[model samples]
Target: MAHDVQLEAITYETKEEVPQELKEKKLSWQKLRRYDSLDLESRSIPGHHHGHHSKALTRSLIFRLAFQSIGVVYGDVGTSPLYVFASTFPNGIGNNDDILGVLSLIFYTITLITVIKYVLIVLKANDNGEGGTFALYSLLCRYAKVGFIPNQQAEDRDVSNYELELPSGRAWMASWLKSALEKSMFAKQILLFATMLGTSMLIGDGVLTPCISVLSAVGGIQVATTKVTQDMVVWISVVILILLFLIQRFGTDKVGYSFAPIICVWFALIGGIGLYNFIQYDPAVAKALNPKYIIDYFKRNKKGAWVSLGGVVLAITGTEALFADLGHFTVPSVQISMCFVTYPALILAYAGQASFLRMNNDLVKETFYKSIPKPIYWPTFVIAVLASIIASQAIISGTFSIIQQSLSLGCFPRVKVIHTSTKYEGQVYVPEANYLLMVACVAVTLGFRTTTNIGNAYGIAVVFVMTLTSCFLVLIMIMIWKTHIILVLVYILIIGSVELLYLSSVLYKFDQGGYLPVAFATVLMIVMYTWNSVFRRKYHYELEHKISPEKLKEVVGGISLHRIPGLAMFYSELVQGIPPIFKHYVANVPALHSVLVFVSIKSLPISKVPVSERFLFRHVEPKDLNVFRCVVRYGYTDVQNEQEPFEKLLIENLKVFIRDGFGLPQSVLSNGENGEEIMDVRQVEEDMQPAEIEREIEAVDKAWHAGIVHLIGETEVVAGKGSSIGKKILIDYAYTFLRRNLRESDDVLTIPHKRMLKVGMTYEL
Candidate 1:
């Protein structure tokens, strides 16, 4: 029956040479026209043309976005004023000189790190419009093949945004560096490790930010009323943290409107109060803006001031949020907010607190509240708490974004990612991550019981992440920006030196709560490393054991297998040929679906894949077999949960390919009647006069409706008999446990249970 069933291979005829009209058009125009011709109605092709809006940054949009960014982007950094002064003077200010010096340090730290490094320089390193550690790694990986995952395709590099001019002259050093990084496996592994370490620290930031921010804010209650005890403050802070995490499910969308206004009001109130206090108290505190005071501060206080640097670093603790949350707002908006609002307000606030401390040295323990006038204490305290919650919300959202990026890059385990906003693709909520963060925050709040110790932990996580970001930024400067070698070295030297100083200061307090983030980062690092290592090993094993498509085709041709009437979609990591699971399935079942598709989903290093360029399809050899190979590509930031829509779009595109023969090289039809003529896929399909092709299309549609079954390989990794006991324990115990407990194939694929079949196999790696 298989031999009797004959199928005609649909083919098209066209010129092999390029047309004169096509050659005459500019490259940019051609690209614009091509994107314009794509079907905008298809969700699969997220319009790449949306890039235009980013390019057209109007004045009104900048101010509006800058104001709006206050709520989300600057919340964490803005609330730092609540605790910086108190944390700095935990042992009480020694003299009037110490207050000025501390204020000076806070002023310069915020200016240098927050405004200069992050706002002016680091923001430029964002991957497309997306930001974060993984986004940086993604940008670097695009220039160099350092990513451990083997899923990237050639077309991934062909993305318009991915293209860059080759380095020349001194810039050749960058190309050489990229080549060196890619050539060494050890270098690749090290790069991967650094990225994971930074990401883990970011997760730690998520836990520590909330604990410190809210505890510090609520501690103001104790300052306002001496009746409040330390335990009461801890309990109250924990309650607020619980409520914050509880409301994560409703997402930031519902409450996002109020964030901007609340934050705007908070900043305005703080800035206004800082000015009022600066004038009313020691106006001479303005002398603290001098860099000489920072040196004088260390010279006078010695080790005490050195230890105080840990607390002083608190002023810039949320600096990373400026860059991490860059995706939510434009760089211009962030820069504007920082330079005009956040930067100036922070400087004045710290100076005003120092002025207040000069006269009332005993109130150093509660500087923020003590500095406030009696007439507005209650309202100011209320605004401070609200601002702290917003700050915590920003970091929590940031944590979700980072985890989502890690999942896409294969560095993190699969977890359910809930899209929190339809308008913003990057806004997401992970249930597992949310609960874990909440628990960790509560634990930290209860354990530390004070802002001073939590500030130590917070400083460690912040400085380490900043240090790692600087290291990564060095590579990005060389490879992506192609900066002059001297400039790159100087950039690293300056940023590295500053961050290392803060890191050392923070690390000095390891016994005094600094170990919290270290422990948190270590645990997260191990999990990420184990997951990525197992994933790489499994993929390599599959590659080594994979059967060639030609061999599978010959074997199928020789056997009298039953041809079933339905579409079978085989999901595999292998992109090129038949997977071993397919061979195993055919050997056992002795049958094949009427239409077979080997599908591979790939995550590219870019921030997003355009909808028109998302799917790449080709017919497997011996077209009569009715076999097709499809690769669905996504950028790390792209949404990947549309399984049903993805399937439907693939089928629709495949039908167009079948009728119009567009995927085949020689089959591209060009209408030469006019230079302005546009070739539409639907029009080409309609122009095709093959009756048999139409019949096949209808039959395939019928088969699709009959049922589309998803076949996935369920592979178990175990050590071979020849392997060491350590390997056995690692694979059979740790890896297997993770696989069993983590999300399964159906969850990742979003495949319905009734239409899915898992074929089990074992691999000894």
Candidate 2:
């Protein structure tokens, strides 16, 4: 069956590389209108054209990034030493063999899952330099037609960094998978659900990580003195969590610098202590590095060892951050820090704990604190608490980032995103999200009260996220990298099996507090899915019911209607033809703006759009009508500064377009910034009279000085009369409630009420 699309929709061809001859010609207004069908590719615009990893780094910078990554990327997993041993034997160890077996599992799991699977393989699959579930989805969408929304344009593929490299050989599996995803809407929905589920699990993980990490670190207070009670520990954790979240407004530049050195000292201290304990207590603990111990562990303990994986998987809790933070640091820097510092420190720490367990089996519940040497116990305890706080801060910031990305892609509701640092692009603070997280973190700390119960909940979110990453990676390997079928299966058999084992163990403990994250993620998934569904349905409706060119001409040509004396920017989601809301406005109001622009704000999959190429302009047919369509594109990570008024920028860019025509290079306008030289009309166009171009520029300036009014369509989405009960409930109730409460468009744009004109409409989808 063919998809239903409006027959009157205008289509344009986009070219990747502009022709040199076309660039040299001087185009008249009539000729310029003809060239508009080329989608403005002739303008020699400069952008961040290189891929994310294309830049070269100095030795000092690489080392600096590696050092900085210690605090931001490795904190969560680094602090895992404080709780791993205690969580593993919550019911007490059966014997020394169980210790050795669990130690072996930890060694291989970290080595295989965190080191080999993530650092070496999955990090390479990053979308241009960004990593996350959505980053992978963005990469796949570039390679195949698997996006859920059907409004993606051909010109979006012309982005400099949106590159694809097809395999030379005929890989049947890759072809088949791509075909299935494109042809079936069911397959696309499943893919979107999986991506949203993974994202939700990460957010859920964000909430649980701070609770468990802070509690485990503060739990050390009990071991330090006999007077401290469990209630005191919980209260101290709550206090620390509140302070940690309170400092998020300061951003990473202020906080991350101080944290790096402290985390560096923390890793060195733990590694040194682990080495000391390994030799002083028992050198035989080195034997657990052998893989055979893992196999023997399962044979003897059987189900007990299997169930212990829920605790064992906690060793690499922050593995996802390694990739998620790749945008903040280079791959070489992350690899350097992991291989030389973090990987070895973690191994020795676990080995030392296992060695101490061999001689003192009674201290299994308090292994980390009890095993610490007496001389540095207090200092180590202090550093442990600070390190856990830093770990919590990292995840909290990451949650804010993912939510912002979701908002940009239309999968999440509108939230006020404050760019916390002017220097850094990724540092953002969402006040509502932060306050809600603080409350949730405090609630989890008070409710669980113990790290063991929280660990059960923590492992489910972590392992499930890991499993989803593996699933996305398999599809990425096939579709993006074009890897052979055999190599892909080997990855599944090795990495996939280990994550499944951990996943099953975590699910086994679901009744014992593991359902917290699952329940949280389920709620988040519904909200995200509901928002995206209605968002797309509304866009589809606009596309189908848009006013055709003939109707648009008739509406404007009426004898009763008159043109107002200013520019009116009609904002809508449609890129082609007049939006139906405009026709409705003309019928009731009987007047139109002298200069009209149908502005469509779009978000792309790339990280940033070049300023020179930001504003794309096309004439609404009948060039003398003084009507145009402008599509402004922003990337997912791009931030629009409120200080720079959107209307002023549009007017300035439009002037450059009218003065230079479509054939001139963008460099001629000095990137549309103010105080640049304006070219003489005689130098650019020989056919058009110089006076005519001057008049157009003067009229645009007059319109700007006269007034600029933003015409935004306020939509109320409800279920149609013939809709089903379930559909009505979802659309009329749940969707309506969320839309009304979240941040509105005027608030985001900061437009004053006097200058803004809102056209309200109701849509029954």
lDDT of 1 by residue, 524-633 (tens): 88777676777777776766677766786785665578888899898886654556777778878887788888887767667777776777676665656777777676
lDDT for every model? 0.76, 0.79
The sequence of per-residue lDDT tens digits that candidate 2 reaches over residues 622-648 is: 555677778777666666655546788
Instruction: Quote the RMSD, in angstroms, for model 1.
Output: 7.0
Quote model 2's TM-score: 0.90
Q: In model 1, what lDDT does residue 619 have?
A: 65
Candidate topping TM-score: 2
Name the top lDDT candidate: 2
Q: Which ten residues in a row have the lowest lDDT in candidate 1?
A: 1-10
Least well predicted 10-residue stretch by lDDT in candidate 2: 1-10
- Please report the TM-score between candidate 1 and the true structure: 0.89
